[model samples]
Target: MSAMTSAKELGPVRSLVPARLDRLPWTRFHWLVVVGLGVSWVLDGLEIQIVSQAGYQSTLGLSAAQVGAVGSVYLAGEVVGALFFGRITDRLGRRKLFIVTLGVYLVASGIGGLSFSLWFLLIFRFIAGMGIGGEYTAINSAIDELIPSRYRGRVDIAVNGTYWGGAAFGAAANLYLLSDHVPVDLGWRIGFFIGPVIGLIIIFLRRTIPESPRWLMTHGREEEAERTVTAIEQRAEAQGVKLTPVPESKALEVTPVVSVSYLRMAKVFFGDYPSRSFLGFSMMVTQAFLYNAIFFTYALVLQHFYGVPKAHTSYYFFPFALGNLLGPLLIGHLFDTIGRRKMILFTYGVSGVLLLGSAALFHAGLLNATTQTALWCVIFFLASAGASSAYLTVSEIFPLELRGQAISFFFAISQGAGGVVAPWLFGRLIGSGTDKTPLTWGYVIGAVIMIAGGLIAWFFGVDAERKSLEDIARPLSAVARGVPGEQSGPSEVTS
Candidate 1:
């Protein structure tokens, strides 16, 4: 271990690491950090799409029910992994957990490719889900902490949105990989390997990225945190970006407790910041319902209402995906420039309104398959960015000590409640009846739910744009908070 500053040497003094890190200009090092860690989402999307598409093949000789069971197993694994590993991330460090999780994913996914039977595949796939689920908590915490405040919003939103890009790529890849010329058994196995191959290359990139300096400070390694920030500064200066010194007044004094109890976290979450907790839960669950309900049942809607051929569903899907991907890429900066509350409200409210209109058009027998697809593309373009911001909201609103576990708690709740329920409810809505009334009513309910999320953001949202994490929500261990307008301690926190 590196030498650390002694608390006794300068009693009650503030550490400059967080301020220094937040004030630095963007550099090559920052980009490397983004790319290296951000690829986790891509790999996750690729792994999921490949399995969903190829799992039901006749070559596997599995019944449809058995294939569906595989998906449930993966989802259950993800929820378990997030809750279990998210706590580990808070106790251990981000760098260690992120690297370990990726290794687990690579090995488990690779082993999954070698599976010859349902039991074999189930075991490895569950392990792989655990890895990706762990990555969510670790990576999001690291990204928000390490990136400069000004760039954090857009970067985080864009990175989360890249999952769609991977899905699109997977969709295209399967078109060729699953073609009749390829044997079904061989093709499905190869599809599983795609993520592992990509992951191996990304592991090398992760090697170069440094541990978050903010995390170091809270762990009582103030000297090491200073050194890490200094190295980052030296690199930025070398890249021709002039570095400005952050004043000592910007520094924060914190009490370094090695661990926080779940009981304390619950108090902080529900008792101390009840409103913010509700806001996070509302955002997560609503987006999960809207996205999962629409995404999982979209093809069935197309086939039933538009009389569209099953074979042509993928072609329609490409445009919807392109809209989703482009939303964050195009509008992400607004989350920083315009501020979080406004952007969140706009994206969520507008998408909900648009969905209402789309629902009406469909009910009226006005939209054909082509127009309906186009309409969905426009609505989801806004919805995707809002959904991505829902993640950003939960990740940022909590104290640094609880960020990982907070993410895990909300993710598990949203996935368990909304994720599990949405598909089943939507499937029932799209029952064997030829009439589209039930599904249309489902759309109206989805719209209402989204609008409710928007209203919650309007009332309870934190305007976290372009502010340090400490500025948004003080670290649980922090002793002397620095934000000018904000109060320092948990008791004094604003709603």
Candidate 2:
């Protein structure tokens, strides 16, 4: 091993890496980070929208049950991937895992396009889901660590929201490819390659981005951490952006550990930081349930309830997706300015209340298909921003060492608890296409779930806006050191 690797294995070290990173002004380098890291969500959304299309059943000679199983299988892969790779990301470092994960998706999805059998396609779909799931943990950790604190909230929210853009793109692509314009066999196969083609371009761009310096500092590679920050500073100066100095008081003291045991992770999550744990789980589960329940069943509701034709349903998705896309773009800055706690509450609360009102109208037989779609657009305009913030909340609140694993765990749990159940339950409620009463109650349940999430956030949420990640949660590796006016020892739980 080299001397630098040896030093990382030694012991405690102190560095200003986080402070140095947070003090820099925004520049092209930051934009590169945003585009490179943020595209993961877009890829995920594309994969989902493509797989959900019905062309697959006719092309693969599959039953309706088998087609539904394919979607479930992919979701199962995401859960497994997040848990397995999340731990690897914490141990192996952010940049390595991100590159490997994206490559996994590229190869798996590309080969999946050529699949001739149901078994073959299912296997690759599972593998591709793993790649995207791992991307969630690795990319979120890297982005939060690399971006400046002041810009972090809006940037993360906006990036998470871009999933809708990819969804919108896939919906638009299906309009051409799935229609009679292309051969059915060729069109469905081409749909599978869309995300991989996009992934190829993003992988090249990701080559220019660096590993998280915060990850380096905590691992005892102080010299390398310093060098990385210096290079970033040089890039900012090259862009003619003046840089500010980071204060010595902003430096952190850390005792390096090669790895944190899962036991320790469990204790820290449930014991040391209980309220923050509650906050993260509540935020993630509520949004996952609401989004999955409504979005997955959207086409059914339109076709069954409103007597709309199945073929025209894809056209309605554009406006629905546009609202979701615009939400974070317009309202994301408030999370940074109005602050995380208040904005999360507002987004969740208003969206929930609006959903309840819409449910009442549907039950009373007052809404047409067009009016119903419009109401959904307005409601999710706010809910999409709130859902994106759920990811942001989980990513930012935990200690740096466990950041990736923390995200994976919550994502996995939420997927199991909310993502899996919501669709099945709602499908049952929308049964036989006759009664609006059951689905109306379903909407009320969804509304109640979201309102409860907002209330939980109001009571337990962290005031993380404008604060450095280290300030939000001290690393387990961090050593208590007395700064002149700052409180000594580990950071107190903000919730």
Candidate 3:
């Protein structure tokens, strides 16, 4: 036998996994890491939640232009972080990137908490985006490995659900942290600080999170993978739990021989996989556009049209925030049960129709405060659910080698096309800028665009519900019109 195989044989069961996590909800090592990463996503969500509030804008003395710019600047940085760092994760490994990104987030958020100028906030916001961008590629991949394949879809949904929770968490924190004790022009700064602090705390906790064993196996590190799995098993055992399936088996195999030669991500990324790329990118764009159009503009809506008192405007958001948090949870079940194509299409279609209908109510002066808020609530909540799950679908439909790069590509490209633009357009329409439109038409425009996104998804997107990522994305070596793919196991490509 070759020295390499001989070396591998010396390692304890370095072949594969059903990773018995010792009869727990999560595999022994996974529970804490997933929880930590979820908290990261939540903090990410919370920061965004604070952006659109009147309290935020008023404190910063921001024009509509500035608000849009902040979102745009942040997204622009996200693009850099996502594209530059995502593929690097394959080379440098997941744990290193996770820790680095967390650091960036903490520093950005720390300075943002003390910002005196809007421009400084924008700069800090951009840095925060870098952290967020880096988090997705590393953390999601980390989560993918820690959990069993069966739990992927649900965990994917669950991870994203934290963003919704973050929204509420941020809003609530703002209500408490900023309550009665106003920061003279520092309310939003203080709001932005919360996430960074939490991210810093998690960094130390995240240190305990291991590198992906799957990744290690592929990289020709059998000893490391075996050692890592053993550590995980031992940890779980100490917790009075034994890994179910005993963590390793002879039946499963890791025959990968990846090297620098395998680094041509372009072929894997740019080949017939265009359909997957398109699906992923389109999902992010559509979701980002739909979300920012409303979320980043919500406070403006209340202040402009509803005639709600300024001091109490944050209170009005409690129900909406709660619904936003729950929307994904309520609707995410549909993804697994109903199938990807159907759930996304159905939710987006309904959300579009609702957005248009709500706009009509506002435009016609036909909506009373009660009716208006209720409709907005329903529409935004539904939109949030569908939009929230967009990343989950995108992330799951790519192969392991390129998954991080693929998601990062989408996050960057789509945000440029849509996400960063939505708020500016809304601001312009609302005349928050020097020239604004009536609030009524803003809703109409958002509704129309969303409907278009839904139709596009229904027509072109592939179904990912029952199939594993590899299976659904198979024949991805070539892109097609997305002709219905067969729901089969991932074509075993010997890596």
**lDDT tens readout by residue for model 2, 308-397:** 898999989999999999999999999999999899999999999999999999999999989999999999999999999999999999
Q: Which ten residues in a row have the lowest lDDT in candidate 3?
A: 478-487
**TM-score of each predicted structure versus truth:** 0.95, 0.97, 0.80
Task: Give the TM-score (vs. native) of candidate 2.
Answer: 0.97
- Candidate 3, residues 1-495, lDDT tens digits: the string is 542353244332235432332123455466687777767678777777676553557666788667667767777777887877787785667888888888888898788777777888888888888888888877776776566555565567767767777877777777766666876466666777778777878888988888876667655566787788778778767888644464433223433433222334555555645555666666677777767777666666677666766666677677776676677767666777776677777777888898877777667677765676677678766777677567776666666656677678777777786776787777667764222236557767667767776776676676665453434554222112223221122342211
Please list the residue runs of candidate 2 whose C-alpha ends up more than 4 Å from where it truly belongs after superposition. 1-9, 482-490, 493-495
Please tell me which predicted candidate would have the highest lDDT against the true structure: 2
Error of 1 at 436 (Å): 0.6
Winner on TM-score (1 vs 3)? 1
Model 1 residue 269 CA deviation (Å) reads 0.5
Q: List the residue pairs that clash in candidate 2.
A: none
lDDT of each: 0.85, 0.90, 0.66
Candidate number achieving the greatest TM-score relative to the actual structure = 2
